[model samples]
Target: MRLIELYKSVQGESSFTGVPCIFVRFAGCNLRCSWCDSTYTFQGGKPFTEDEVVAQIEALQPCPLIEFTGGEPMLHERELLPLMQRLLRDESRRYTLMMETSGERPLGEVPTEVHKIVDVKCPGSGSAFGSFRMSNLDALTSRDEVKFVLRDRRDYEFARDFIREHLQGKVAEGTLGGILLSPAFHQSPSPLRTADNMELDARDLVSWMLEDGLPARLSLQIHKFVWEPQKKGV
Candidate 1:
């Protein structure tokens, strides 16, 4: 596998926020979102075999949660599937695998046991809108989550409409885990300049959600508050 940094940190997003988890960050990405924070992963990272990756995780004793993040982890599904299977099959380890993807890739290959967090890129991401695979919506279960990173009112509205059109009913029916709304964190080279609106604060997003009565959880990147925003390996 083309491995990036593998380390233990508190999960900063998704339903597992604030939970201690081991992160397996894979190198390389297919899209270049203007607000991407982990551009470091887009290029070089040390290589590690599947066994070596498992060994490193095993060394992080007592952590029951594991997240496979990226540079788009789904891009490595062929390599990641077996690793997840091996970890799940280990009787001594009680690891709950989580895979975070951009939602641009197909989720059909991912295992049902894994908690998949699919990010439906808002226009603020500067990635083409509607790039998400709509089929993945049917693939979701109560254990999976959908995230939308908002940059402004337009982005919020885009997410709101998407939820209303696709996810709201399923979420209400309890078939989907739930939707997440996060304010797009500004990074170096500034996506704010490119995004349609000015800078947005968490309060801005909250106000929009309140007025619209959107059915989603407001999430902040907890790790950034806990550590330096530019820090690597959380």
Candidate 2:
């Protein structure tokens, strides 16, 4: 598979936040979001065979949680599927798998055992906005998650309406996995973090969610706070 870096880090988003996990970051992406933090993943990565990828993952060790993320991991589902199968079916250890995708690809083939964290780009995400494959909503399982990255009240409202329309009663009915809304961050590749890295404050987001009673979780990329905001491999 075409690869970026494979490293162990604490999961910084989704319901699995703060958990120690191994991140398999694949290279290349189709969409360019306004606030994308991983633009480095769009191109230029070392090549690795499936076996090489497995060896690196095993080196991380002890952390049973593994996340397949990328510029977009779904782009390599052809190879990823078998890798996930091997890890899940390993005789020495069992790994909990996770994937983060842009929700623009067909997910019908993804295994049910993998925790899929799909993103529905808010209008503020610019070019990637409305690029989500609406059909993927039907593919989400109870172990899956739908994420919305917001930049302002307008984006928050868009998320609210989306859940109201397509994700109707999923949260209340417990038929689907968790829904999440996160503030877009101004990413800078620097060691000294800036004062305004976050475009939308988490407090304001929480207020909006409470007032509207949106049945979703408030997701903060905790790694940004724990480490430098633009630092890679975390």
Candidate 3:
């Protein structure tokens, strides 16, 4: 598998936020979002075998939470699927697995045991806008989560309409795991650790959510505030 740096860090997004987790950041992406921070993962990464990757994961010790993230981990599904299975099926120590993906990929074959946190690109995502694969919505089990990175009211509206139009039934049935609306961060945020660095204020997003009574969680990329906004890894 083409691999970027694999390290232990707290999960900065999703319902499992703030939990200590190992991040497996893979290289290469098919889509480009304007607010993307991991553009460095688009290409050029060291290659490692599945066994080697597992070894690296084991080195992180008793921490059992692992997340497969990337430019797009599903793009390397040929390798990622097996890796996830290995972690879940480990006889000595089983790991709770999660994946953060751009929703542009087909998730039909992903193991249901792995929690999927999918991103639904908003209009402000530049070329990535409206790129989510509608069919992937069918694969969302109660263990999965959908996220929308908002930059403005337009983006929020898009996310709102999508949930109302297509996800209403699953949400009402409690079959969908969660819906997260995180504000976008400036691609090049200042080194300062402050809310001003954020492209959209969380307060504004919360207000909008309150006004509409949207059944979505207000997610902030907690890792950004915990470290330098542009820092790699956690």
Candidate 4:
């Protein structure tokens, strides 16, 4: 596997927030979102075989959750499957394995036991059309989540429309398990001024959700606020 970095920390997002988790950040991505933060994972990573990668996780004794994230985890198609299978075999670990994906590839390749968090990139992200594999969404269970990082009101509208148009009929009618709407964090204009950037404010996002009664949760990248934002490992 072309591994970028791995470490143990509190999970930043997802329904399982604030829990201690092991993160396996892989190398390379297919899309180029303008606001992407992990440019480091796009290339220049040290390569490690499946066994070596697993060994690193094993060393993080007592970690119960594992997340496979990256520039785009699915890009490294060769090593991902075997790695997930190996994790499933570790009886002693009893960990909940999850993956953060861009929703560009065929997810059937992933093991059924692994939870998937799919990202639906918004228009403001230059790579808007590059995300969201509509065909593979139904393949996901309630355990999976669809996330959108809103850059502005337009992006939020796009997300809402995408959900209503594509996912409404496929997923069960009443309630969906996990759907998150997060605003992209930007500080160039001014760090303390929350609404300085084109990104939507949390209050506005909540208002939109309440007004339309959208069936999705709202989240923030908790790790970015909890620790040094630039630090590679969580």
Candidate 5:
């Protein structure tokens, strides 16, 4: 596995926020989003064999949650599936595998057991040119989710409208996994708290969701608050 870093941390975003999770952050990404926080993952990282990666994960045994994220996990196509399969091999592991993706990759190759958190890039991310596969929506189970990181009012508007136009039916029935609308944090110079980490305000964004009647939830980077943002591990 071409890995950037592996460490244990509380999940900062997603439905599993606050849960202690072992993160497998891989190097390299196709998109250079304006608010990309893990810029460190976009370049050089230590390479590990699939077995080595799995061993590191098992070392963090009790976490029960493993997140495969990246500069873009999908970019490392060859190793992802094998790593996931290896991690899930132990029923006793009880590990809930998750991956954070840019939504630019084909979901067909991803193992069904992995909970995919697909971040549908909004206009403000500067990756609007990237094609999002509409067919991938069908592959998402209730355990899967879609995410949109908002940068400003324009981003919020785009997100709100996107949900209304392409995602309303799913939101209305509450059958879709879920929609997450978080403001872009790295763009905000003023840190939200003493943590000195850039991040979005959960309350402010949640209010927008309520006012717009959007089904999306506000996802804040809890780990950012608990630890230094630049730090690799919890």
Candidate 6:
């Protein structure tokens, strides 16, 4: 597998926020989101085999939660399947395997045991609007989560309508996991303040959700607040 960096850190978003987890960030992404913070993962990274990756995770004492994140983890489905299988089969310790994937790829190859957190990119991401795989929605179970990173009010409304059209019923029925709405974080300071360059304020997002009665939880990048926002290998 082409590995970027593997380290232990508190999960920064989703329902798992604030929990200590080991992250396996793979290198390379298919989408070029303007607000992307991990651009370094798009290029060079050290390669490691499945066994080597597992060994490194095993070294993290008392760590039970594992997240397979990426430039886009679903890009390496072939390599990830066996690694996830090995982790699931291990009897010495129980591990919770979670995958963070852009909803652009087919998710059929991933095991049901692994919890998936799929990102549905908004227009503010600079990617083509409505590029997400609608089929991925059917693939989700109650254990999985859908995340939307809002860059502005438009992005928030887009996400809101998407949920109303696709996710609200399922979420209410207990078939789909909860929805997560997060404000996009700015990677660097800008001289001029603009919606495109500035980080979306979480308070504003929260107020909008409350006013609209959106059925989603507010997610913030807790790790960014704890460490330098641009730091890699967190």
Candidates in order have lDDT scores of 0.86, 0.89, 0.91, 0.81, 0.79, 0.87
CA lDDT for candidate 1: 0.86
lDDT-best of 4 and 6 = 6
Structure candidate 1, residue pairs in collision: none
Give a tens-digit lDDT track for model 2, residues 93-144. 7889999999999999888999999999999999999899989988988898
Model 6 lDDT, residue 8, Cα: 95
Candidate 4: where is the Cα deviation over 4 Å? 169-176, 187-198
Ranking by lDDT: 3, 2, 6, 1, 4, 5
Candidate 5's residue-wise lDDT over 144-182, tens digit each?
889998766777888888888877788667657788887
Alpha-carbon RMSD to native, per candidate: 3.4, 1.5, 0.9, 2.3, 2.3, 2.7
Tens-place lDDT digits, model 3, residues 9-81: 9989899999999999999999999999899999899999999999998999878989999999999999999
Relative to the true structure, candidate 1 reaches a TM of: 0.93
For candidate 1, write residues 80-170 as lDDT tens digits. Answer: 9999999988888878999989989999878888999989988888854668999989899989989988778898889999999999998
Taking all chains together, each candidate's TM-score versus the true structure is 0.93, 0.96, 0.98, 0.91, 0.90, 0.94
Off by over 4 Å in 1: 189-198
What lDDT is obtained when candidate 4 is compared to the true structure?
0.81
Q: How many residue pairs clash in each candidate?
A: 0, 0, 0, 0, 0, 0
Better of 3 and 4 by lDDT: 3
lDDT of 4 by residue, 112-182 (tens): 78888888888888855556777777667767888898888998999899877766654555334578888
Candidate with top TM-score is 3
